[model samples]
Structures are given as structure tokens and as C-alpha cells.
Target chain A: MRCPETDNQELLVAYGAGRLGSRETAKLEAHLAECEACRVACAAQATVWKALDGWEAEPLASDFDARLLARIASEEQPGWRRRWREWLRAVAARPAVPAFAALFMVVAGFWLLPRGAPPEPRADAALVREIEIIEATLDDLEMVKELSGGDRGEGARSL
Target chain B: MKTGVQQTVVGVAALEHDAQLMLRVREGDQASFGLLLEKYRAPVVHFLYRMVQNQAVAEELAQEVFLRVYRSRTSYEPAARFTTWLFRIATHLALNWLRDGKHERLQERLDEEGEGQTVRRDVPDRRPSAEQILLKRVRRDEIRAAIAALPAKQRAAVLMHKYQEMDYAQIAGALGCSESAVKSLLFRAYETLRARLRRLA
Candidate 1:
């Protein structure tokens, strides 16, 4: 008779938990009857399971409910501020949000930062200066025209 | 089996109820929120306590868990069981706490004889002699320590499996892993447990 392989821990765990299919369980059982090592392995796993049965977590204190309620009240007090922080944290924890935010900030900084030494001056101030320069030039032209002749219209007519 | 299908249908109905409770919670029903907290507080605390092996830390984390649930109430989705959602939050916190090395000092503190002394007092004094009581305490401590020694994912797997009585599907949903991954986790976890607790067996 060919002995079945018993080295599969998954099968053993399922067998121990009685979760294995009937055919698999039967085969493991047949192997277990004949194999000392597999049997010992199963027994050890079984013992671990048995020992775990006694391990119950201690009951919460009687005031646990009250304490939790108190916590809920405290959390509700500052409400929106806490909510914002939680939202911020959740958003920050997302892989793409922070990356996108960082990329945006960097692009924004590059776009807004002065490319060279601060702008020569305000554009409005430059415009005002140019207007003053044009006014002065016109005033100079008038003076030249007066210096050239008192009646430029008469001069043009004579020409 | 027909019964299995019936059980699935029942489970879905129960989950719908939980979802409705969450919906009420979203609607600013304080009582509904409190009801949820009351229902899940012990199980969450117990699961965390087992994960961290420190009651204070466990309780603190449990509070954070519920606080998170409340904080996220507005965005609550009824896609899964509330318990599954709750545990996923919890398991994330515990894993982070462990990763931050916060538990290392606590584990050391637990290792000291004095700390174990207090844990022993919590036990009802049933043993006839001090030695038997001491022995039993040590054995229990050993089991806890062995469990804590497993990697965080494996430990979470085993805790959900053994304590929560959650099957592979539930655990996978909670841990956000495949069912096969959960099986591997449990297999490795129990393998370590078997190795560590062999003498006891």
C-alpha cells in the first residue's frame, strides 16, 4: 500500500480543526495511523489549540461603558476641529493626495516665485513714469517750437 | 448545504441591521452611537489587549478606535459588516503601535517578575499552594509571550482566528489580505506556537 504524504501543515491544520474535506481527512487519518512524526505534529498543534481554550481576555471594568461614553462626549466637544484633523490625517495618509499636494505646492511656488531680482518696479509706477516722460517730451517740443518761431502756424503758411 | 446558504442570508440581514445603526449614527443619533460603542467595546478591547498584551495600551487604542469610528461616521459605507470595519481600524492601530517600538519597553516591563506578580493577583486564588499558582501564571505568561513573539501580521491572524472566532474570509477582509495569505499567516503563527509551547504539550 502507498502511504500518503503527511507533511502539509495546511492539511494538518484543517484536519485538526475538522475543516478538511472527507476525502482529505480520511487520507490524513490513514497516514496519521501509520506515521509517528505526523501524529506528533498533529498532537502538538492540538495541544496549542487546547491550551488556547483557557485563555479568555479579562472582562472590561464595569465603568468601561461610562468611560467610553465620556470619551465620546469629549471627542464631540471640540467636534469640527477634531473632525478636520482626522480628515487631514486621512487625506495625508492617502498615497496620491500627499504626492499631488506636494507636486502642486512645488509647481505653485515655481510659478509665483520671482524669476529674477524683484520686478524692476511696480508696473503702475513704470506706467506713471512713462506718462511723465511723454509729458516732458511734449513740453520740450512746445519749447522748441516756440524757440524756432513764435507763430509756427504762420511759418507753415509762409512756407 | 441548504443550511449554509441560510446562514449566509442571515449574516447578510444582520449586517444590514448594523449598517442601519451606522446610518442612524450618521444622522446624529447619540443613542445609536452609544449602542454601537457598548456592543463592540469589550471585543475591541479584548482583541487589542491580546494583540498588545498591555491592558492600558489596549484600552487607549480601543478608545482611539471608537473615536475614529465616530469621526468617520459621515463617510460610513455599508459595504461590509460594522465589526469588520471596526477591526480593520483596530488592527491598523495595533500594527502601527507595534511598528513604532512602543511595545518593546512594555514587553520588557511584562518580562520582569514584578509585573507578572500583579497579573497573578488578578487570578482568583484557587491553588492550594503558592507554587502551583506561580507555575500556572508562568505557563500563561509563556503562552502570551510566545504569541507576542510572532510577527505582527501572523499575531493578528491568530488573534482573529482564535479569539474573534473569525474564519479565513472575515480575517482576510479585516487584514486586507487574501484568504491564502491568512492561512499562511495562521500556519506560521501556529507553527511558532507549537514550537514554543512543545514542552507544555
Candidate 2:
């Protein structure tokens, strides 16, 4: 094995486990010839491989298959039927895009229906104009009172 | 009757004679689901118990996995090996349970308190006596403990390799990595196992 690195021992161990490619193995073999350490590494790796085969799985519990299948059976369903129904539901779910858009616009417009329009003149502006007219009338009355002061007795009776 | 179709049915039948009830669960069959529990209640419960190292959490999580399997029944495919799939699900749940960081190991010692106080024997002088069996069990336990000591990836690689007889490719799928990575995982796992088993050797 052409060893790629001193670290190739670990990789060689992996190689022995069938993990490494042939090129990697060839490289490791090349290293093994040149490096005594790698040979020892391969040997050390051999012991573990031997033990690994003897590591049997624990016995399955007596009822393992029974329960596992029961679960599968309970979960069984008609493959195509479910798919078909789902397909139909999907087809039924669609509405034309423009129809949907129109519906949405209608709902939005209903919510946004405008408030009552303001009059031509606002209430505050009308109030200010009325105040100006009243002030002019008060001035006019004051002028008339001054002019009529000489004839106050007869005018007062009429007034 | 010996036609391939007949054989297929027979195969599926033999597979389910014990757990046919579980088959019903996929069909939303509650009765079949109940029968499944009747058949597999112990194994499922104990498997989780061993997996999580906690009886209560195992029981709870086992129930959840079952519910999940039940919920996802419509997509169930029978083409694959059932035990592998089931254990895959179980393994995933157990791994998630371990996200809390090896609760099962700590709990195992606490639960077995006063039991392993002595230097347990794993191998005997070979006459195959009662002592030999006891020793064998102890050895197995030690090996198991060593296996448990490995990092999660190595432990899974080893367990899947050993217990599941999965090829490195299948392990790669379960591990969500490349086949080469799985090989490295197994190699590291073996290195650890060898070191631990050497004293017993």
C-alpha cells in the first residue's frame, strides 16, 4: 500500500473495513512497504475485525414481528384512492385568478366606502363670516345712535 | 396456489399473522391498531426502555412514534424492510431523546444501582456451565457499555452495522452522509470497541 501519510493507518483501517477505494488501498500498500509503523497499524486493525464478527445482536423479543406488522396493517390505506381524493380536492379548491381578485377588491371597497362629503364651505368658515356680519351691524347701530342723539327723546319713544 | 402471487400473499401473511393488527392501523383501523399493541406492547416498550435508558420517557416517546406512524400512514410503503424502517423511526426518536445528552446512560446506572458493584465476569473456563452463561452475559453487558461509550455517530454506525446488518450504504442513508463517512464512522467505532474489549480478551 502506498501510504499517503502517517495518518494513513487510520485510513487503512477504514480501507480494511471496505470503506476505502482501491486507489486509496494501493497508496496505503505503497506506504506499508516503506513504513514499518503502517504494517503494525494494519495488524492492530486486524484484531478488531475479528471481534466485530462475533458481536451478535441481542435476541429479538418474542413478539417483535407481531407488533410491528400490526402497526403497519393498522396504518394501511388504499394508495390510489387517497391520492385521487386529494387530487379532486385540489381541483375543487381553485377559483379563477381574476374572480378571486375581483372578490377581494369588492370586499376591500366595501370596507373603504368613503365617509359623507364636506359641504362647499366648512362650518368654521361659515361661522367666521357670520361673526364679521354681526360686527358690521353693531357698528352701523352705533353710528345711527350718534346721529339720532339730538332727537333722542322722540326717537326713543318710537324706538 | 404456489404461484408467485400466492407466495407473495403467503409471505405478507406470514409476516403479519402475529401483527396483522398493525396492518389495520394504516387503514385507520383502530381495532387492528389495538391488536398491534397487544402483540408488540412489550417489545416496543422494552426497546424504547433500552434505547432511551428511561422507562417513562421511553414509554412516552414510544407512544409518540406510534402516533406519528399512525398519522403518516397514507404515505406508508411496504416495499422496504419493515424492521429496519421501524427501528429507523425508533432510532430517530431515541436520538432526539438523547439531545438532552445521554440521559439513558446515567439512568441505566441509577436504575441498576447495587447490581454491578462487583467485578462482573464475562467469560469462564469454557465448560459451558451456569457460571459460563453468567460470564457471557457480563461480557455482553461490558461490550454494550463500551458501545454506548462511543460518540453518537460511531455508536450508530456500529449498532447499525452489527445489529441491523446494514451495509455501509444503508448506514450512509440513515446517517445523512456519504458512504465514505460511514466507513470512517465504523472504523472509529471498531477502534474504540477493540480497545475496550482487549482487557476482556
lDDT tens digits by residue: candidate 1, B56-93: 89988998998899889999978877777889999999
True contacts kept of 2: 0.15
Tens digits of per-residue lDDT for model 1, A9-75: 7777777666779898887888789888888888988888877775678767777767767667656
lDDT of 2 by residue, B1-201 (tens): 399999977867877343344455667777765665565555556555555545667666666666666665567666444454555676687787787776867666676985757655566465588786688778767765776688866776666665456777777766667888988888777767766776564
Give me the candidate number with maximum lDDT.
1
Please list the C-alpha lDDT of all candidates, in the order they appear.
0.83, 0.65
Please list all clashing residue pairs in model 1, or write none if there are none.
none
